[model samples]
Target: MGDILIVDDERDIRELVADILEDEGYTCRKAANSGECMAEVEKEPPSLMILDIWLKDSDMDGIDILKIAKRDYPGMPVIIISGHGNIEIAVAAIKQGAYDYIEKPFNIDQLMVVIGRAMETSRLRRENVELRRRDVEPPELIGNSPAFRTLKSSLEKVTKSNGRVMLTGPAGSGKELAARYIHANSGRAEHPFVTVGAAAIEPERMEEVLFGRESPERGIEPGLLEQADNGVLFFDEVADMPLGTQSKILRVLVDQTFTRVGGTEKVRVDIRVISSTNRDLTQLAADGIFRQELFHRLAVVPIDVPSLDDRREDIPELASFFLQMFNRQQGLPLRTLSEEATTLLQTTIWPGNIRQLKNMMERVLILSGGKGEIAAAELPGPDAAPADDQGRVVLSGSLATLPLREARELFEREYLLTQINRFGGNISRTASFVGMERSALHRKLKSLGVVTSSKQGARIAHLDEQPAG
Candidate 1:
């Protein structure tokens, strides 16, 4: 829908192509050499480029321009045209990322067809990204407590604008969920809503995963930035992102462009960023662990998600919601929480917030064993021993009277469960705390016959599948 730049040294040839394209209802621009071509592109990237592989009296040739364009503006389709085209040159152009190659004396009809196909191909790629994003169900922001209502009101107000948002909250407090809610409600709802788990991805592969990589061996793998074009890019636990990557992300925020990991050309994107963090970014920035400029850019519309402790009144509703969700998802029988059981849930300390509550509800439903009403006695009790200032639970129980094997099993189960609860049911953190591999911990839990709902089992299986560090 934008201008198409035709690059060639010869005045007549450039004018002819421009005139034909103009007649075909495409706005046309002309560039006589590589320098002019790049200038025009930098000024305003055209939807497509018609490039000449040979340029006379120009500091750089058409092939050089093609390389730069493909590297930087990878999404923009480029058609290489050469007057003295050969098989090798054509192959080279295509390998360098050109959409197609056309020899001199090109057929007018064929040229139009290629142009149409190239533009359509680009459009379809974007549409595919959006479609894939739509396949993911948006997370619901459920709750009617004053804390939750105020949070929803703030989210509704911010969704009307394109301001960058930074969600601050404790782990599992629904920051990522809040970010998704904003994206799903925003004007860019129809586009992709890509998430980058800052802590989940290994540091070595972070750049490649975020900015993508392009090489002859690897071909082209678009990064999260490109996939999130015209949509939202949510950074989960942004404080976990490395400082070096933080600076690069900051540059992208400032310039709206970035080069891939193995690329030299800049890839421009239109994206709205929403980042969430459980850590104190202000203190981190002051300590130089996080970039101050980047933090300010991300926190333009800072919003704090209330912890589960702050909204205990929502527990009964939230518990019921999770119970129904798990039942429907797993095709299990309907179950209800007794008033006493509900009261117990409300009184318990939910260190993991909504996610912990959800997991606990799933466990309760699984353990209910077809009972229509879950009892207070069925629920797992809150932490047995008060955690010291260092968060280490000191158990005050004796297994001296029990047999060795029985005592060992009981101790292991209690210790593991306590540690798991301490870390808010994050298996990875719990594994790290207990000095066990994630898979090993899962196997241990299974061997101990610790009952887990299907959803928790799936999550454990997913964690087990990841390669060990």
Candidate 2:
């Protein structure tokens, strides 16, 4: 049950392979030039590609396409076919990542055998990727509120189709988790689920990272698009992707295929894209930072995840869920929150949404030793400043002895770290509050040697106590 694409400039050859392969119980498709071949591949990558060495009226020759295909879909098998085959060209093709070579007047039995072998290789590689993939527990939405109910209903509809989804929400509002939930319930659940942070990838290397790269000597290095073939690709912070890269991604969304970096062959992929961003994409588009057309394509089925404050009724359930989950994972004793503490949690402004609550619970569990009920008095709050006995800000060492630039750097780092920790490592929230661009904030954090927590373990340090009456 494999799909095979046969690429040959000659009409006779195209028909012959299509007829032969279809008779052999494999789904067969044919293309006349390099463009057609790549178009088919990008729309829905075949298990194997049979390519000609010299493609007439094509942008690139067979060997060139082979290298690009191999790079974009490393596990995909390609068999080189040539009427003008020689030892030198065959050896070169093999070196450039072809699985095997076939001569123009080849035996039917031999070609079928090679096709079977190549299909088997592709199957085995995909199986290996699946086997090595981590079996992570799906994140729970954990809410009984009206807003949550509507969200669940909408998600169910979205999962039934293969439409591109745009998730817009505040940081730590479970956009990635919602995307995962949709993937888990979709038809492609058995396939790979790859995630890429658009902001994290540098603009210079963004193409190579997302679309992959090809080299005659190095073969092909598959990109995230190929890796997410037949499954889901979640792009976190998609608004931060460079404008040029956004255009390339738009092409992929439009045609379901892309050419790799330094290669002319189009690599096809069958992936459902789900992009998320905490920023206002519309505003960014108006400001000319983000592409408006790309935004529209990504927002075909926009879903806005509610902030924690909007769904306060679900706080108790979420808190208890996280408490139990942490207990099991950390091997801590069972714990419960006191009534006063629970009330305080529900009333406070959860700036970092569910993520902040999870962080607070983790901190509380650790601080309370996890054996008994957690009291309101023991909880830590958002503020992160150490004051002296005279109520003055405390500075480590002697600031006056240091140079102005060095002192300023130290203060900036401290301030950013404090705000980041207070917001439970929510970069978007911190950026907005600090009046800095999110990308700029990221650069600053990287330069300052600050590594933020992963989305799964994002934490907001809590206050000492709240006015829980």
Instruction: Please give each candidate's TM-score.
Output: 0.56, 0.55
For residue 27, model 2's alpha carbon misses the true position, in angstroms, by 51
Question: After TM-score superposition, what is the CA distance of residue 206 in candidate 1 from its true location, in Å?
Answer: 1.4
Backbone clashes under 3 angstroms, per model: 2, 11
How does each model score on lDDT? 0.81, 0.81
The C-alpha stretches of model 2 lying farther than 4 A from their native spots are 1-136, 383-469
Q: Write the per-residue lDDT of candidate 1 for residues 1-469, one digit (tens) a residue.
A: 5579999999999899888989888999999977788899999988899999889889898788888888898888999888899888887887888888899989989999889767755654555456456547766888876678878999998997999999999988999778878987889988888878788666766787789878754367687889899999989889999988998999999999999988999999999999999899999999999999999999999998988876665788888888888878897667888988875676577889899998888887776686778887788877545568898966555766778899888888766654554343567876886799999988888776553332121122245544344
The TM-score obtained by model 1 is: 0.56
Task: Report each candidate's C-alpha RMSD, comma-separated, in the order given.
Answer: 18.2, 17.7
In candidate 2, position 138 carries an lDDT of 55
Which 10-residue window of candidate 2 scores lowest in summed lDDT? 456-465
Model 2 local distance difference test score: 0.81
Lowest summed-lDDT stretch of 10 residues in model 1? 452-461
